[model samples]
Target: MIDISQLNYSSADFWQQLTHLLAWEGVSDAAVTETVRNILADVKKRGDAAVVEYSCRFDRLNVSTMAELEIPLNRAQAALNNIPVVQRQALEQAAERVRRYHEHQKQDSWQYTEADGTVLGQQVTPLDRAGLYVPGGKAAYPSSVLMNALPAKVAGVKELIMVVPTPDGEVNELVLAAAAIAGVDRIFAVGGAQAVAALAYGTETIPQVDKIVGPGNIFVATAKGMVFGTVGIDMIAGPSEILVICDGKTDPDWIAMDLFSQAEHDEDAQSILVSPDADFLRRVSESIEKLLPTMERQEIITTSLNSRGALIQVADLDEAIEVANFIAAEHLELSVDDPAEMAKKIRHAGAIFMGRYTPEALGDYCAGPNHVLPTSRTARFSSPLGVYDFQKRSSLIQVSAEGAQPLGKIASVLARGESLTAHARSAEYRLKS
Candidate 1:
């Protein structure tokens, strides 16, 4: 009885309907924007005092000073030591895999000397410090700690600071353990726009970070957007999305659960299945109905599917790919005999999970790929968070005196053409008369 939308490719208004379904405006309302602005301004002005005040007001913490809000590294270590053996092992394994995967993304500095003795190259360097935001309290996301922190650590960031909100003094042991495993240097019990402001502008206690990465609620996202130029930030992600292009050969139950995986994230999360076989789509719909009651997050799954999920009937696999490219989903699954072949045609997607056995959940945890991906059709332009996000490149150029002559003449002409007399004269000075 799930009221998921069903779309037919042959329908005259199909494209329009699809477009409407994909549209999601993630802009923060004026009220939220203004509130974030005020919070940022206050934190910038008052430093630790404003942060402490906001934490007491918003997080309901009984604290008088910034010292009370800081969580020590030994606490994270203790949490790691005390967690269940199996859970600890799982965390270690996941961390190792994530570390190994990001190591491949580590960039190195390179240089070369030209025939004219002009040295030109690129130097790669990691950020001095980074800030990570984790959702805490009732929600525990250890996987997020691994995905965001490991990449920065791998990129050789000198310090990694983590801020998690612990409402009413509630903290998740697993999150603390994950922070220990990920090597986060400092931990602060703060959240919302206030925490973001502290990271962007620097409180007396919290050091300003070169870049801020991780996920949060509407307020945090709004704050990140507002302070983007002040400090680098990851993309403003929208709700999670998964698009499955099936060949009607995979088990309907597996495919159904795959779609449910993203839907369970929240009511706004989108899940769509595209296939040529009408019978397979029907079977998957039935599977969704049957499986709904068994899930602990059944209500959330149901609401998500009913509101934004879809089961689309396409003319063939080719049409399905066309729809996928148009949607530019965050997670794309090609559940077919030849997923590799089909993946070649995919021009846009945050991450592609190939074959029937592969699911989006695997990528979210231990698949060795980053789960921090672009969402809300941003996959077309942006990419997932990786070691590269924590690193920067600088162009290296050292012109030899002899090499400067020809280059100086070229620069002089271009500068003069652009009516930049100072630039032209500066370049002319290096030229032989």
Candidate 2:
């Protein structure tokens, strides 16, 4: 039997208990931060030489130059063609769906003319290049490739470069195949902080990118955090999280498995279920005990459930939503009678899976939404990765001679108030004598 924590909303210390459970220290330790800082500095200074050295040291590769690290685009296409017909078709379909969905998010440049003939608007433009880091070797996450790369492509990025670590020379064909389907322009076999540094600072072979996106280990995450100012990054994601708000109507077995889905990601991943029915929570706990032994990752699920998982008894569905808003989980499943209505009240969540039929796994795969989402309460402020992430906006302001006088006068007043004579004079020069 799993030893997951049980919380009751009526308890005076329920909030304190929940807050303690929700806490996760995601920041890198001093040693890790220092290691990342050194790697970044080395890569920035020595260029391709440093990246090659780290790749060899960390990835157990026998390469001597950065050129050997580069994976030809044709190889990705070949992987697409060589893989099982079913896998290839699935990747293509997923890519197409992701592309189609992001197409709607594309922002266009627009301008409006004022009565005084001044034009003001915004111009939307895609980044020149973007870097995607996929965990390589035994881990095959074609969905991540589709999720991160397709959005940049839909935003019309000029070039998309992907880097995956081929530890001991092992490569994942599925990731390459997905990249081909997503139209990734370049591929490199490198990983860790060195790969991030190469993408951020530019090397002899790897051109610097405007932004980097995708998941990696502690070293990679730390490197991304350090290089944030030099290049844009998706959120510094925490562990996988799923919060299910059930009205005691869904099958106990289904709810148990849903919780297990995220728990199986790793031991640190969190899975919680909130409901008004006490008996239903007991049944789900029983299901977890009964079904866990059959899973391949049972040990991982067990540790995760034992450590971070919970079954909370709330007063009602409204209270569940209130708790969810406070938690701001990365993935929220509304397994209630009126999921749509409940979703209407959800103020914060990375992704909302509505109804018992819509599971979080669907959104993770071919559900036509980017699975890259904010974690660790970041959903309170950030959003899921979309075409908007790869696109930038520039404000357009063109003042006509007649309009310049009024605008300049206003600017001059503000600049003078700030005690900047040069700024005031610069604006005043545009005003009428």
Candidate 3:
């Protein structure tokens, strides 16, 4: 079968082996970086002209102007109406669920008054506009539209612009339908580094957005990284990752298929299974061998499993959690007897699929949680794409006459200690005589 790596947690070099397996060079190479840098500069300088040129050159379109590149609202609505009834219903239901779920995450402005009558608080407000990038053409990800757009709408963003590349003039109706249902303000059939540049720096037609969310290829990722300071980004996501902590209770076939789910995403995607039962680990291996050949993306799954996948034999479930924390995978599944209890100890993971019944695929589509999660080890520090990502907070501070003296003295002292005469004087002026 499949030549997936097997390791033991008790081995002295287990940590080193895990580190090597988890390592993925996400940074763009110099050539790709330079190409993205040039694209950003060109698009920023020439506006729609550069975007149009790149779109035609890269996407194999012959469109002459940016106006031809935009998908009209009527067309988007038509897509929603023309699609299969079941698909439309599914999109609507998913959109509603995503909207409802993110509604709870919406931050509200709040203030509190001190005893001295000073006011301090946070003012929360949505962004003016946000740009979303969808890998288009043959990439039929209506879920991406729902996941990225609904949160911004829930946060009350005034406008949302969507960019999806239609390579070879092929368009995905479901993506358009999702855009219509999610209330995307604008749709542009342009993608890649040029689309990112057009979003970062406003063009003749595409308005620059306050932030950009969604996923793309290496070129798009590099462009996002380069233009980060100019606008906000969700995260520079890595390959898909899934780590399953099984206590040998779940079906071996189910576990094998679950690992295959993420591995099928790409050849670089990673899948790992940790368990205390050596016999169960062997059973899962057998399941992978028997089940992989039946998969549609068998070649991709094979390559991914051969290159990055692992079936680790841990000392026990406790050690499994320890290894899970060290990995900080993008998606984690607790397929054990006490999933809830094991989940309570999980300190790092982009999303935790608790219980054997809860599959990670649900979260990817209609689980009422945004599937746009922090990949790689970023789960340790970052979070999933949520309404909060589309909103900003401003600290509120007000000082009464009685409160000014004490605050002013504190500020003056800090400013003077830093050797800033103007800053110290500005605060000192508010001090009582």
- Reference-based TM-score, model 1: 0.99
Q: What TM-score would every model get versus the actual structure? A: 0.99, 0.98, 0.99
- True-vs-predicted CA distance for residue 353, candidate 1, Å: 0.3
* Distance from true location, Cα of 6 in model 3, Å: 0.1
Query: What value does the lDDT take at residue 270 in candidate 1?
Result: 98
Q: How many steric overlaps does candidate 3 have?
A: 0
lDDT of 2 by residue, 11-111 (tens): 99999999999999999999999999999999999999999999999999999988899999999999999999998888888788888999999999999
Please report the candidate that would top lDDT against the real structure.
1
Better of 1 and 3 by lDDT: 1
Name the weakest run of 10 consecutive residues (lDDT summed) in model 3. 373-382
Q: List the residue pairs that clash in candidate 1.
A: none
| Cα lDDT for residue 407, candidate 1 | 96
Candidate 1 — which residues are off by over 4 angstroms? none
User: Could you tell me the TM-score of candidate 3?
Assistant: 0.99
The positional error of residue 126 in candidate 2, measured at the CA in angstroms, is: 0.3
Give the alpha carbon lDDT tens digit for every residue of 1-433 in model 3: 5999999998999999999999999999999999999999999999999999999999999999999999998899999999999999999998988999999999999999999999999999999999999999887799999999999999999999999999999999999999999999999999999999999999999999999999999999999999999999998989999999998989999999999999999999999999999999999999999998899999999999999999999888889999999999999999988889889999999999999998899899898998998888888898899999999999999998889999889989899899998999998888888
